[model samples]
Target: MLSTTNPFTLKNIADYQYFSKEKIETAIQKSSDAFEKWSEISVSERLNFIKSLINTLTKNKQLLAETAVAEMGKPLKQALAELHKCKLLCEFYLQNSDFFLTGRKINTDGCESYTKYEPLGVVLGIMPWNFPYWQVFRFVIPTIIAGNTVLLKHSSNVAGCSILLEKLFTEAGFPENVYQNLLIPGSDVKKVIENKTVKAISLTGSEKAGASAASAAANQIKKAVLELGGSNALIVLNDADLEKTIPEAVIARFQNTGQSCIAAKRFLVQRGVYDTFMEGFTAQVAALKSGDPMNENTYIGPMARVDLAEEVEKQVNDSVAMGAKIVLGGKRNNAFYEPTILTNVTPDMPVFSQEVFGPAVPVIPFDTFEEAVALSNQSDFGLGVSIFTSDIEAIKEKVHRFQEGAVFINALVKSDPALPFGGIKRSGYGRELSMEGIHEFVNVKTVYIK
Candidate 1:
């Protein structure tokens, strides 16, 4: 049985029964059947359906936001922000999907030649719990609007959010089986991936899960898009405006209580300004409010579950044992982990090398701009990096030196509906937003005529 416990109260919220193998077979068939008729519709018709879905999201925003908070422990305000972002995703596709899927004319010797985008039949999305609504919408919105049906196998902890999402689709007038939630555990994910009717897979989770899913898809000769873990760096150059850089650095590290794959895990500051940055950064982190997730004013909440909090604690303790110093918070109470900062950290420590998924970060000092870039690229993850400096033009020339998927100057790295978001190396592969994202599950067909 799949179940959820409130991260704040540590009390059971609900339980869900896993789908049997036979039921999985039925769901896939239903999705395949739905894809045929759904894919045959006009792009204009699809946009109208998406408009209805957006309206449904608007009507049920509070319910959806609260469900995420009850299941995951994100602050209520942030949860609402997640729903809002989901709405923006739907609206983005609604406005541009027709153009995105439209065939393009190519200059060729033939009388008429061009390329067309067609959806793969049934695409399965394996999503995570953090930013539950936004993650699911980012993957599903574009895929379905491109004329594909979806089956979601969400994180076990956020089962409520998953089931509710399926219902929202139906309420929005989506046809039967257009979007179904598969209530199954991680073990059964391979079974779904191996199903012949399941054409493609899009997953957002840990490295191990992405590897396993990619392997299964490989064996089946099916395509998969994986968005995995990241230990991103927030590099503060010696010439950076500390006023602007310090506040963004705090939000980059501690937002969503630091449970994001794209959250800034390492702070690489130039030696000249390292001490000054720490003073302001530490003070801001200390001033953050912690309380019940449902509380509007709570800036910090529990880590989703007790085990997750324990994992962060282990990373912190191990780093301290390896000579890292805890300059600020380093305490855990059940599922609640205090916002933590570690200094005197080397690249060898767990906090620096591994993806820390809770409210903790490590600060490392660098001697030169080249060293800061090297320190940022030292990890197995290449999801993204952010550099803060006043010399935008000089930094622009050096942006190519960092081996990351995305980079932000004078700001934190973020995912936008209009921009492509994904990573290389251990962070997994394939894009997830914008034109590239909508095309990930589509067949780019070339046609020529005499």
Candidate 2:
């Protein structure tokens, strides 16, 4: 049995029995069957169903947000914001999916030729607990609209949210089998990926999980899209406006309690402004309210689970042991971990070398803008980087030198419905969101008329 315990109170929220082998088989078959009809429908017709989904989500947004807060430890307000973002994603695709999926006509020696975007069959999604609703919706909305059915195996900790998501789709008038949530453990995922009916897989999780799932898909010669871990750098130049940069830096590191994959983990400030940046940044972080996630005033909450908190505490403690100085908070109580800031952090420290999936910021001083870029690129994860500088035009010229998937100027790294979001290297591959996302599961076929 998979049980969901509220991270805040440590009480059992719900329990779910894992899907048996027969149930899993039935789900795969149903999704495969549904794809036949779902793919046959025109893009305009499919969009009508999506419009209904947006309405259903709006009606139940509160319930969805509350469930996420109970399951994970994100603040209630942030959970609601995640649902709103999901809605925006749905709206964005509603306006643009038809144009994106439409075939392109091309001149050819034959009578006529063009490229047709056709839907693949059933696609499997292996999603994580963080940003549960937004992660699933971003992948499924586009996949279903493009005419591919989805099979979701959500994290066990968010089982309630997962089941609720499937229900919302049905309430939105989606057909019986277009979207199915499989209550199976990670061990069972390989067999499902190997199933003949499952055409592709999309995963948003750790590097280990990505490697395992991606290998299974590769063995089946199926496509895989992964949005994995990140240790993004937040670089502050000497010329940066502290008034603007400090607040953005605080949000970059501490938002969502720092569980976000794109959340800035390292603060690489130029030596001239390093002291000022740390002083203001720590003040902002210290002022953030930490309490029960349900509270309206709460900005920081527990780190999803006690083990997760323990892991983060160890990362902070280890860094301290390695000559890193803890400037602000670094205490753990049950599932709650204090928002921590570290300075004198060297490249070899755990906080600098690894992805800390908690609210712990490591400040590393650099002498030059070139050194800042070099420091930012010194990670195994190449997800993104946020550079704060007054000279936006001068920084624009150096953006290409950063070895990251995205570079944000005087802003935090974030995912938007209008832009492609994904990372490189160990952060995983392929893009999600925007035009690149909807195309990931579809077949780009060549049509020829002679």
Candidate 3:
């Protein structure tokens, strides 16, 4: 059995019967069978089903939001926002998928030559607990519209949300076997990946999990898209408007209780503005209220699980021991961890070097832009980075120096349906959302005519 314990209440909320190997096999076979038919449907027809998905999401937004809150401790408001984002994504693909998937004519020696986008078969998605609905839908929507079927093996901690997602797809009028949730443990993921019916894989989770999934997919010679961990940095220059940047930085780090992969984990501020940014940032973080995820007023919630809270605590304690000062909120209770801020943090500290995966932001002072860029690029995970400065020319010159998948200027780094999202180095590879995402599982075939 797979059971989900509410991090906020520290109580068992739901239990799902695990999928046997035979059932997993059946899902794979059915998805593979469905893909043959699904891939043949016109893009306009697929858009109709996607439209139904958007309507279903809008209709059941509250229910979906509450389920995410109970299962994974995301604030109800943020949960609802995630569902809305998913809806927007559905609409995004509906408006642009045809243009994205349209064949392009190329100049060639042949009489007529063009490149066509054709769907691969079934794709296996290994999703995580954080942003459960968004992560799954972000990958599933594009894959399906590109004419591929999907089998989800969601995190064990969010089993109820996973089951709810399967139901959502069905209610959206998606054909049978088009989107199936596999209620299986992580150990069984390899078996599903090794299944010949699955043509590709996409994962959103930890660095270790991403490495393992990539290795498994590589062994099968299957295409894989991995959106892994991030220790993203928010660089604040001396000229940056603290009034505007500080609040955005706080949200970037502490929203969703700082459980996002793209959340700003490291704050690299210029020495001249270090103290000013620290005062405002710390005060903003201190004012964040941690309470019941279902509470409408709560801005911060429990860390997703007891073990996850403990991990964040260990990182903070270890960093403090390494001469880092806890500016505010370093306490932990059960699964609830306080929104923490640390100062005098050096590169050697775990809080500076590792992905904290919680509401803990470390403020590291830097003397120069070179130092700030170096500090931001020091992490092994390079998912995204944010730079705050008024000089557009200076930003253009220094933006490429920060090695990350996405860079936000005077704003928080975020994923958008219009932009391709993914990272380089240890942050994992391939893109999600936009045209790049839909093409990830499609075969770009070159056709030559005599």
Candidate 4:
């Protein structure tokens, strides 16, 4: 038996295995070897196989959802909902892959021109634990349908779920390395990237990690697509429907306990309606329930880990000391953060620029329309933003004016496999869903034949 020293200073909530250098190499080699056979299959065939994978997920929904909740402390109900969303992404891609990946014919000048989508062989996908299954499924189904095999480097905290993912894919008839999980520490991720077999990389993580991966990918001249953190603002203008906007705003902020990448992190209310909006928002927040994820009554679960909870608590304390006010729920018990709401956040506070990535939200009021747009564009991260208004003119103006990847109006912004999802600035680049995702790791070939 080989004795191993675990590299992580803290044991992950799930005790995920840290793969050795040799193991990563082996997985990469397997994926490379498997790609030939997998890619040889027709796109329609691959889509059918992925549809079967969704069916498997449906049959095993409870077991998988329970595992995710056990590993990361996500609400059981929400976790079940996550499973359903995963299925949606699966079927969405299955139904639409043919449409997105179909050869495109264009009338360029007087010549006949058609563009074909080709697979990039092998793709290395790095995922986070917050939405363990959804994130991977969101990336995997699309890539596989595009004729690419996947090598998942899921967050160590969700290692067990990682195992289930591979099993599900294999049982669904994925070839040897068509979709494989590498139970590895991220410290050695560069080695996997450096491999000749890894044609490209995809990531959904913090800004720091995305930068590191981008550098690694650039060094090797391989393609990389990233969806980093976000401090997405939920802007509510004066003329907006106050009743509808108020409840949606609170749910937008605290959904996933506000840990979501597209979660409304900054509340930029036009000062004209700020006072009235805050009154309703704060009351709904105060009435929130916080406790065990398994308890159906609990509206807020623990923050995934004790250290993460502490980090969130520190951000709240530091910001409040610097003059921010907590209107509701700022306490922490172990890994559980109270569903917190703060006001008077300045741009300088770490909480404002950096994604809180927890169960807390910061509300900043702006006086004018220009100021609202300016404040919304005031972050390094620009993944998604929500706009609440009945004004068609304002919506048109902001969509043209806002500096984020996706803009949501009258709805919470989220990733749908049918739509392209990614970010800009520090939020990283490249689109993740739709035909955009399929082509991200593929050689978009333009054949010019006389």
Best by lDDT: 2
Error of 4 at 126 (Å): 0.4
**Candidate-wise lDDT, in order:** 0.93, 0.94, 0.91, 0.83
C-alpha TM-score for every candidate: 0.99, 0.99, 0.99, 0.94
Which residue pairs of candidate 3 clash?
Answer: none
Task: Single out the weakest 10-residue window by summed lDDT for candidate 3.
Answer: 392-401
Please list the residue runs of candidate 1 whose C-alpha ends up more than 4 Å from where it truly belongs after superposition: none
Model 2 error, position 245 (Å)? 1.2
| lDDT by residue (tens digit), candidate 4, 1-450 | 111111122233434347767788888888888888888888888877877887889998898887777777777888899999988887777777788888888767645778888899899999998898999988888888888889999887777788899999888877778899988778878888988889899999987888899999999999998989788999988888989998898778787777789888888898889899989888888888877677787677777767888898999999989999988888987777888888888998867877898888888888888898888899988888888888966587659788899998887788887788988888889998777877787777886655
Candidate 2 lDDT by residue in tens digits, 7-46: 9999999878999999999999999999999999899999
Off by over 4 Å in 2: none
lDDT for model 3, please.
Answer: 0.91
Task: Give the 10-residue window scoring lowest on summed lDDT in candidate 4.
Answer: 1-10
Residue 335 miss distance in model 1 (angstroms): 0.5
Cα displacement (angstroms), candidate 4, residue 108, comes to: 6.3
Error of 2 at 237 (Å): 0.8
Clashes of each: 0, 0, 0, 0
